[model samples]
Target: MEHRIRLAGPAEAAPELACLRVIARLPSHWSVEILECGTGYAILGLRTRVPAEEAVARIDEAIAVLPLLGWRRD
Candidate 1:
């Protein structure tokens, strides 16, 4: 399933994003940075898992779309 990721720009928003839940089947996930509350905006990245046979194609689609999800780890 495709997951939608949203950014929380405030410290208060952290709890919501920091504690985001995902299905167990999805790969391990975590944020590069725990953005300071009420300080900066966070960029979020999202993609759905696909079967090996379909991965390449889906990757292309993911690439075509803006990686609204954050690309940097640091």
Candidate 2:
């Protein structure tokens, strides 16, 4: 499953990038792609063998704790 998450602001780029880097370095069931979109960045999240909703929930849980990286899911 893959999800494209739109960030709330450009200020989130640094912390989000840092967090994604850490996630990439660890053993995981998922992969994330960060791309610059004008002033902000977008995240493309992919998880194999997981339901689409579950993958989204996992990403939501990860982003919820971040002060600035959270975005509106709707």
Candidate 3:
């Protein structure tokens, strides 16, 4: 299954850096990538075979710390 999260922030190197940060927080079995980046938002694509609820929980947990890195959900 695939899930997407939109992070609102500067569109510069911040997006790539944020992607790395998120990747570090997720389980190794999951695949993550940047799907789109705009002036003030970035879309991250997460792919995993985990159940929907578990996936959402893991994603939320990973992103919960994003604010400290200067990002917020969009």
Candidate 4:
């Protein structure tokens, strides 16, 4: 199954990219894709055999620490 998190605008992309990089390296049985949705929007695609809720929880955990990395949405 695949789950995606769509983030709008360039403002969120940098940190999201950074965070997602870590997510991509995490110990998971999932595959991650970074997709450019448009001029300013992006998508974080997660393909996993895990449950949907588990994927969401992992994504949420990554987002939760985003601010600590010095990136915040404008």
- Top candidate when judged by TM-score against the true structure: 3
- Which ranges in model 4 have alpha carbons more than 4 Å from their true place? 8-16, 22-25, 37-41, 66-74
Worst 10 residues of 1 by lDDT: 65-74
Q: Write the per-residue lDDT of candidate 3 for residues 16-44, one digit (tens) a residue.
A: 66667777888998888889876767788
Q: In order, what lDDT does every prediction score?
A: 0.33, 0.52, 0.73, 0.58
TM-scores for the candidates = 0.22, 0.54, 0.71, 0.59
Q: Give residue 20's lDDT in candidate 4 (0 to 100).
A: 57
Predicted structure 3, TM vs. truth: 0.71
Which pairs in model 3 have colliding backbones? Answer: none
Residue lDDT tens for model 2, 27-61: 37566665434334454545467777776676566
In angstroms, give how far residue 12 of model 1 lies from its true place: 9.0
The local lDDT score (0 to 100) that residue 31 gets in candidate 3 is 88
Candidate 1 residue lDDT tens string, 1-74: 33333333334333324323211223455222223323333433444454443433432333233322332122
Clashes of 2: 0
lDDT value for candidate 3?
Answer: 0.73
Q: Write the per-residue lDDT of candidate 4 for residues 8-32, one digit (tens) a residue.
A: 4444456445545546544476787
Error of 2 at 72 (Å): 4.6
Residue 61 CA error for candidate 4 (Å)?
0.5
